[model samples]
Target chain A: MNETADTMNVPRSRAWTLFGVFAFVALIAAQVHAVLTSPADRDMGHLQKILYVHVPAAWIMSLAFLVVFVFSIRYMWRGQEKDDLLAAAAAEVGATFNGLTLVLGMIWGKPAWGAWWVWDPRVTTTLVLFMIFVGYLALRSFVDDPERRAQWSAAVGAFGAINVPIVYMSVRWWRTLHQIQSSPSTMDSAYVLGLRTNAIAFMLIMIYFIRRRYELARLRRATELIADAAALGGT
Target chain B: MNAESSLAVDAQRIARRFGARWCLRGVSLQVRPGEVVGLAGANGSGKTTFLRVLSTLLKPNAGAARVYGHDVTRAADDVRRHVGFLAHTAGLYDDLTALENLRFAAEMLGRSPEGLEASLDRVGLARVANDRVRGFSAGMQRRLALARLMLMHPRLLLLDEPYANLDAAGIDIMNAVITEVRNAGGAALLVLHELAPAAGMLDRVLTLVDGRIAAEGDGPAANAPTASAPTLASAAGAR
Candidate 1:
């Protein structure tokens, strides 16, 4: 039993570390480019630089939610417990980035929009989603048995994930306090290239973070099971 | 892997891990058509894990499990179409009435509800079919779950602790159900905590300990009191 836990524990491989390094390097290069070449936005000025991180982080929020959606649906259809865990790990990472997106959006808005926060449709709906997933994760943590936790969490994840689109579509449907989306096609070549590079960098970084987080989650679960067995007097 | 072949089940060195710990390790069991096998184990002895692996709810890390010669890992959808799994909680929606729950499962399994009433009556839940599962007693909930087995008419049945909350009469009803399945030339794996009551229904008994099959032998001793099987007691003590 002791050996079983160790065998299943995911080691942080050198390749994973290297991937992390490359992601950070790419991020720094994009940040440097955004800082050095691009002129201040006529409207937003220096606040635009925050866009490099904030937009990508926001993009990750949805991408991560999508991961939860896919895994949750698969779990429901097939009843695979691991799919539930994968969905849970993705939800945690998504919640982290979603929070970052919210805070960074505020930091940008304080100067440009003259308000620290706004009850815009996108922001409000995303906040609701963040709360829903937060509840999802909380429900998972509160449960003791693995099977029960998986079943309950998968149910919540599948139902809660429906809110992701509501967040994006909220901006389009009713009048919102948030700004309309900036047109991607209208961007200058240089600005677009910078944004694209940073987006890719952020995506790579997001992948690393989610993978590392998943491994950590897996290890933590393993260690906890060992401790539980020990508590039960298993040798 | 052809769905039409009618192979019962073949598990090859199936190992399942939970995080870093093994829930079941290098475990293998086979069941052929018309076999009623009882899986006897103490708590945490990997009985549920083994069932989950067979049901395609959890994949084994290092081996293959197939139902009807359908590889659970690769041909899971096909395997699921043939197997009906019942966990401790019945896996039924608490808010849904018995009929609704059966209807939902029927739709998901692609089984028509044309004979759902017959299934409910077979499980003795037709009288209370309109009640939400939350209002049902444990025995009632279990009966509703068994009704699911009847409605689907699956080729293989996996029951985990199906007798947990049942009274003596309920156990008889359950045994009748298992016997009916066997009579139809289907296979059933019943995970049980005690063998005395349901031992007669099984053709053989397989014991589990520490995530592996500890013993595979004849059905529980008929003349002896079934309570003496210390497997569950030992497991409880281990915990």
Candidate 2:
């Protein structure tokens, strides 16, 4: 690690690293167990196995967006720098998972739906949600002042979060090619354990990603503040 | 004692830090109404940070500041109403016309954004009132920022590098606004690297070195500050 990051003495804890390791191991274990235990689907054979990663990733992505929504609201309500930083971190992480979810969904769609993509309400809304957050990240980079960036981002974040529920409900609200949702209750007894375990693993990984990303954002902000002070001759 | 309570600014040992670096160590100062104080220092001396603390852009970490009797931290909104702070950047929207910019400020301040043409005329930007700030020259942009202060009716003006891109006429317009604020029982704090351009308009010069006031000197006339250049230069250079 660069010695300068230690200037503020904000130590990065070992717990996050340990948690990160556990999460990845658990994810791999879940994938391996699901591939072995679950028999081929009646309609789709082994192709239904994509549901393990796709469903869990989609769930985790939605959770990340919800985190963005909560933190953005907190930032606007309290005007704390931490809230803004957390919101920004979750937004970046959410955008990453959103891209992942879309890709995974397409991979499943190509084989299962026999199309690479469809104008499905669920898919379209998720794409729109992804675009809004990309624009949110772009706005953050474009604005130079920290305060302005936080304010504009908080507003955009709050508005962008409105799309999450829309994305979630798109299938039921409109007759879409995308399935409504998959859960332990609706899935077969054999697949429920895999789906539940995969969701749990995905949640753990997301927590690790968001927490580590937030730590980096805090360090980056500290560096910028220190640089401003250094430029002005303060030590 | 009553008069002291009425001072436009009263800051006591204000301290603020960024990360592990202390930008302002412990700075204390007072500015009476009808005064313009020039804050001069070399880069990194905390002159700009001091201004930021007072303007409520950044809060003090270990001390206190009050603008016109309102605590900077606890009553930041109240302090903001009395302060017209021109930060390092002009903080103007590029897409908005000069007139529209002033109108936005007015509306933000809860005014109706009417009678704004005269603000443009005051800054000699009347001809380009409808032109977007993106197309305006640096000097013109500075003038538009000044027009915003004029509209706000601030009791304390905090300006950082007010003369960087200004021409002679822009300089005069800025000084006139500062003078207007002083004459109306308000005060102004100016952070300037080069003192000569605004020297004649300042009432006192405070040289901040290493995050503290190192020297102070009186201005030219009843309220002019030209005579303080040497104090500022000597005090800043001594560091």
Candidate 3:
């Protein structure tokens, strides 16, 4: 019962330090292994190397959104402030990765598709998903009431998550310019190992970023509670 | 503990801090069923903060507070179920009509809106029951909030400056409702700047200075024009 107050009081700086070292080492190693071992495609050549960053970024973005959706549902159902904190943290990180994915895709497209932008279904839907969560973050900033903010943002977060699946399946559903989903079974073995290693690296960094963001949010909430207490003059 | 002995509010050695300064320090009080306690304090003195902590809107940094035996920190939902909080804001939707606001409160509390009209009439806002709150005057909006509180029938009422923006008739209505709640065996902790008008309604009055209780006495002494009284300062100093 007494544990609720400090439930989010994890050793934040130490964990972040460990994650920073591990992520940097793992990412450098994975990128090196991926570039050196995977042979360039016959048609796309070096342009295919962009897949290691772009595809893994998209995966991490989707994973972050998934965390937002689950945490948002938990927040609404249980009305725990910590759950809302996690949801907000995940949304911010997810939006960053979502933007990164879009930019990387655009960069990859300039070389492979001969253009910087396209109105492909996958690309368009991912843009829309990004906007929804961005709007969620905006709403949190505008609302003053903690409970109201949590309720409204959780609803938006959950709705934004619905678009994630649509974005993932857009290529298959509408026959857009974007290619269909890839899997290790269908890909060349050389590319598969590198892609898998990079995916792990990206996942580690995403988790680290979300945890650090969550810690920052917890500190902010604590400060706000203190200010409220001070203003009211209650013990 | 037996059901009858359960205090409506029980706070012990509660302390709250904002950065380096403390808002409430070692402040403690309790209210039994049928008790109406009026808390008097100057601006920025922490009356509202204390009510907020009791209502479970803010958690204390140290010590504990319970509403009807439910811990404010651990069982906030349980505490909220039995508590009605009238904050500095009316907490009403501007777009919703007075009746709609009461209905929304009822829906949120999972209670039936059986006496919605009666509640409105009690607060003297029945004529404007269907009018949007955005269009209502501050006193009328406060009346609408009071109606919502009456409809909710909470066991513990935490009212922060309930008389703000109220006219004479509105104040009368507010006083009548507070009296009615006490007569029905519920408890209320009212935080107010002026105690003269509410003196008759309160069973006890506590004067807060710099976050701690400076003076405490029965109703009449609280109503005595002590705005600049040396006794209060001396009491605060003696502490």
Candidate 4:
């Protein structure tokens, strides 16, 4: 309720730059750690290294989607436009990472599993999550008015958010043929440390993305309102 | 004999600005219980802005408005509970049936399921209860919105162009409903272009020109022959 215009201008560039440096360092460290600490699995060979990128990216994607759901609900309840803008920004960033996660997962899956794609529980659910976000973005684009857009998008965000838990649960409840939760609990301490660092770095990257996108949204809202005011009456 | 003596709502020097432009400036008025007040204005004359502020949809930049002792800003939820606002959009779900739309509104307002059926019939939409609003004509949708209005039975009704684009039958039904509300001791602020059309239903008439009240109070302009060109100072000085 006490928000001001200055709140929208958080230092996005500083955040982005810091996250970029962290991600780059984490990338190099992950590769080095993989080379020094562990031998390639005899079955999957060198392809397993992709886990360093694929797994953390997947975690970050899910986290971003979670942010989208939280902010969307907050927006609807409070009617605060900032929450709506943040939700949209997070959904966009999440979709980008989710798309990347899916592509990289497929890349890792092909040789190890002897197929380019499989109807595995985790993969299928992630794909569905991607489609839901795609629908969210499409819905946002279709609406024109800011308040109406926010209201409708919040509803869509809420409905689509219900799918997230379902996606997570499907792998556990029925197990339609995805790898059981092996990666999170089974990794060695050093490997876990690398993955966690990468995940934190990715989170920082997403924070930066959402902040920048929010700035753009603020600018768009200002421009549209200006045009409306001008059209109404401008001497 | 006189339920109209008490003021149902009051606005004290209410002012709202969008950026540099003031939509309402130094606007003050009183709405008596059982009285229908008509807010007449030209396009962009700030009627909608004023109503939005009063309804707690948009916060005012200055001054205060109270609905039945509830402060609009500090106690917005309380204000919302007592105020029923129907903006130009009708605020209805186009995908749901007339009954379904009213039922959802009823649920939102925390009305019992039993009341939903009665409210639908009250608004004359019981015959079209099964039909989806997507297939509803403008009149049908307007009736559906009226059904939503019945669910709340609000103390202060804020309607923005409720009769606009409505057919003759729609207007008649709306007039009847509004008249019934005023008779039941509810204060209403109706924004309309043609005051003469609704003048018979209104207890008082107020004109807004350039974000300030041009002239207002007690019945239509009876004595003033050329009330249209009232000076801004005279308008602002209205009690």
Per-residue accuracy of model 1 over B127-173 as CA lDDT, tens digit each: 98888888889888888888887776778989988788888877888
lDDT winner among the candidates? 2
For model 3, residues B1-239, the per-residue Cα lDDT tens digits are 76633999888867766555667876789899899998877776778889989988787866788888888998999998888888888889999988999999889878887888888888888888898899998888888888887766788888988888898899999888888888888899998766655757888888878878878888766667765355445333211
lDDT of 2 by residue, A1-118 (tens): 1123345324778987899999999999999998899998777788879889988887887888899899999988988878888888888888998898899989988877778787
| Per-residue accuracy of model 4 over B54-154 as CA lDDT, tens digit each | 89988775678888777889899888888878787777777888777877877787887676766677667778887888887766777778778767888
Candidate 3, residue B34: the lDDT equals 91
When candidate 4 is compared with the true two-chain complex, its DockQ is 0.04
Question: Per-residue alpha-carbon lDDT of model 3 for A1-235, expressed as tens digits?
Answer: 1223245455547767987789979999999998887787777777678889998998998899899999999988988888998999998999999999999989987877777776666676778888987899999999876667888999989877876676667644665454543321245667878899999999999888898899888877666554554555433
Q: After superposition, how far is residue A104 of candidate 2 from its true place, in Å?
A: 1.7
Residue A223, candidate 4: C-alpha displacement in angstroms: 8.1
Interface C-alpha RMSD after superposing true interface residues, each candidate, one decimal: 8.6, 8.6, 7.4, 8.9
Q: Pick the candidate with the highest TM-score.
A: 3
- The TM-score that candidate 3 achieves is 0.71
Chain A (candidate 2) TM-score to true chain A: 0.86
Cα error, residue B19 of model 4, in Å, equals 14
Task: Looking at model 4 chain B, report the run of 10 residues with the lowest lDDT sum.
Answer: B230-239
Candidates 1 onward: DockQ, in order:
0.08, 0.06, 0.16, 0.04
Residue-level lDDT of model 2, residues B100-135, one tens digit each, is: 999999998898777899889999999999999999
Instruction: Rank all candidate structures by their DockQ, best first, as comma-separated numbers.
Output: 3, 1, 2, 4
Candidate 4 chain A: minimum summed lDDT over ten consecutive residues — where? A176-185
Cα error, residue B231 of model 4, in Å, equals 9.4
TM-score of chain B only, all predictions? 0.89, 0.91, 0.90, 0.85
Off-target runs (Cα >4 Å) in candidate 2 are: A1-14, A167-186, A219-235, B1-5, B12-28, B40-64, B84-154, B157-185, B190-203, B208-214, B220-239
